[model samples]
Structure formats: C-alpha cells, structure tokens
Target: MNPILQTTINKAKTIPISEERKAILQEFIQYIQQKVDAGKTVNLNFICTHNSRRSQFSQIWAQTAADLNGIEAACFSGGVEVTEFNERAVNSIKRAGFRVTKNGLENPKYFIFHSDDSEPIVAFSKIFDDSANAPTGFAAIMTCSHADENCPFIPGAEARIPVRYEDPKAFDGTPEESEKYDERSLQIASEMFYVFSKIKK
Candidate 1:
C-alpha cells in the first residue's frame, strides 16, 4: 500500500467494517483519486433500481467525502426508469447527520440535501434534464446489480464503476429495520469520511 494510504487506512478500520468491506472502501477512494487527479471533474452517478435507498446514500456520502478530503467531484443518481427518491433513505441520511433541504417540494425540480460547504449532491429520478447540470462524459456508478447489467451503456459516461453496497432496505418492515437502517447509514458515513481523509490534495 502507499505509505499515505496506510496512514489514512487507520481511520477506516476504526469504523465497524469487515475486512472485505474495508478493502472495497479503500479501492473506491483510490479509484476516485485516480480519476479526479487526471485534472478532470469526476461526475459519479450512483444508481439503483429505484434511485432511492442505496444510491441516495452513495450520492450524499460521496459528495461529503469529496469535500472533506478536498477533492472536487460531483455526485448524482438514476434508476433504469422514473421513480421517487425513497423517503426512508432521506430520513436515514438526515438521522446520520446530513444537511437536508427540500428545494422544490411538490412539483419542484429536486430535493437537495447535502453539506452546505460541500458541492451539493444532486438527487433525481433519472439523469439531469440539462447536460450542463452534470459533468459531460461522467462516470456511471452502478450501486446495484440490476443496474450494472441492465444498463450496459450510460450515455456520455467516460467509465462505469460498480461499487455495490449492502441494501438495508431488505430489513424494511421487520423488527430490526430501523436499527439496521441507521447502522448501515453510519457505516456508510464513517467509510466515506475515511476515504476523503485519504486524499493528499
């Protein structure tokens, strides 16, 4: 491992991540760094079936992580089709401590909830209506298998990276649901913080 990576890795293990998960988190940081350091603005589109739970988590944390680590990047989300951003996901991120604001409530354009200091993470049902609203030739990030295979080609994406995460939605409606949701959200936040902490600039 790079000496700097080792120094920052200590931050990740402090979170309750398994060996495999910790590795995934590290690799993701490295991937984003490699992409962004090329003097390019990285547009990461984290996708799920509904553009709801897992993708939403990735969108906020990725932007927050980029800001905390001083990396310039943009994060977005999409589904194979149109659907609402899940409320439970929004509530989970809020409980995990994101700055959430409903900009266009009820027929509004989007719901922007992000750290005020960070580049706002944009969450919508599909790709942004305007190309200028996003990075041209963005990176297609598949957060779920359904998206990974179903959508083989994301228009204008320079690359596609699959960074799948555990779906706490599986626990929905069960006794342990809320606990799992919050637990998973914390886990995502901690790992993201660890990643941003790794960047040199």
Candidate 2:
C-alpha cells in the first residue's frame, strides 16, 4: 500500500461510528460475507443523484477497504444523471492520500490510485447502469436520499442498500467548503473500513 494511504486508513480506523450508522452498515457487511462464503466475486455499485460526491467517495473508499482487508471486490459509482465528478470531492480524496489524475474535458474521467501495485480506479459520472459497470448480481448501495427515492428500482441489483450521506455540496462557496468535503470523505472512509473489518476472511 502507499504509505500515505496507509496512514490515512490508520486514522480512519479510529474514527467513531454511531450505533445507528453501524446498524445500517451491518447490512452491507452481511451482503459481502454471503458472497465471500459462496466463493463469489463481490460487486458493489454506489449510487447517487449526480454521482459527483457521496457515491464517488463510497465507491473509492469501499474498494480500498476491501483491498486492505484482503477481500476481493469490484467497486463502482454512478448516478441518475451524468455530471462530472465534483472537483471538491476529488480534492478531498487527494487530501486523504489517494493520487489522482484527470483525463478528458467535459465530464472528465479521473484515475484514482491508492497503491502503486493496484490498478487505478477509473471514475466519472454516468447512469447507474452504464456499460462500464456490472450488469447484474451487484449490490446497489444508495449513497444519497434523492437517488434512493428517485431510483425506485435498480435493474439487475441483487441487493439494494441505502447508506445515505449528507451533501457537502450544501456548503459549496462557503468558508467551510473544504472542511465539509473532507469531513464527509473521512466519514465515508471510516465507515467503509469498519464494514470490511468485520469480515472474518
């Protein structure tokens, strides 16, 4: 693992998760465990309205957590509508120690690297069922209330888990913009670490 990302994970391991949040995250843990027990590959698709922030954070952190825990899982993020991954969110990921590189113009794709040995996570905004994502037998992790409510059905999802997060976009243009984005990123990273930590494998 990258030393910086390892340090970030060490910090995230200590962040507290509320009892209510644990209850919600437990569902995700169980889902992954079931797949692991069955010797099946785990596929997780984090979903949000714009796929610009929360969903992106969830996907990246979840994959990193799974990798750290020696679990095999494919993580992806998408939205109800296409919009580039928010720059603020991308910066927050960089602050968390992931090396990121941007490509393309409008709705640019981001290559996020947590470790030099692992393949970079190619991230961008697209519909939940975009061709790049798994077509079936994946968990649909709803990362925002809007997308959860609006997307009544996610075709091909074997499980639909709602794990909503507050929008740091609300603080955009405010003095606390960066702080809020970092806070949300850390919160998601901590919870994802917690989820993977529970796996017996």
Q: Which candidate is the best by TM-score?
A: 2
Choose the strongest candidate by lDDT: 2
Clashing pairs in 2: none
Q: What are the TM-scores, per candidate, against the unseen true structure?
A: 0.77, 0.98
lDDT of each: 0.66, 0.94
lDDT minimum window of 10 residues, candidate 1: 1-10
State the lDDT of candidate 2 residue by residue for 1-201, as single tens digits.
667778888888899899999999999999999999999889999999999999999999999988878999999999999998999999999988998999999999999989888788989999999999999999999999999999999999999999999999999999999999998998999999999999887
Model 2: worst 10 consecutive residues (lDDT sum): 1-10
Error of 1 at 12 (Å): 8.0
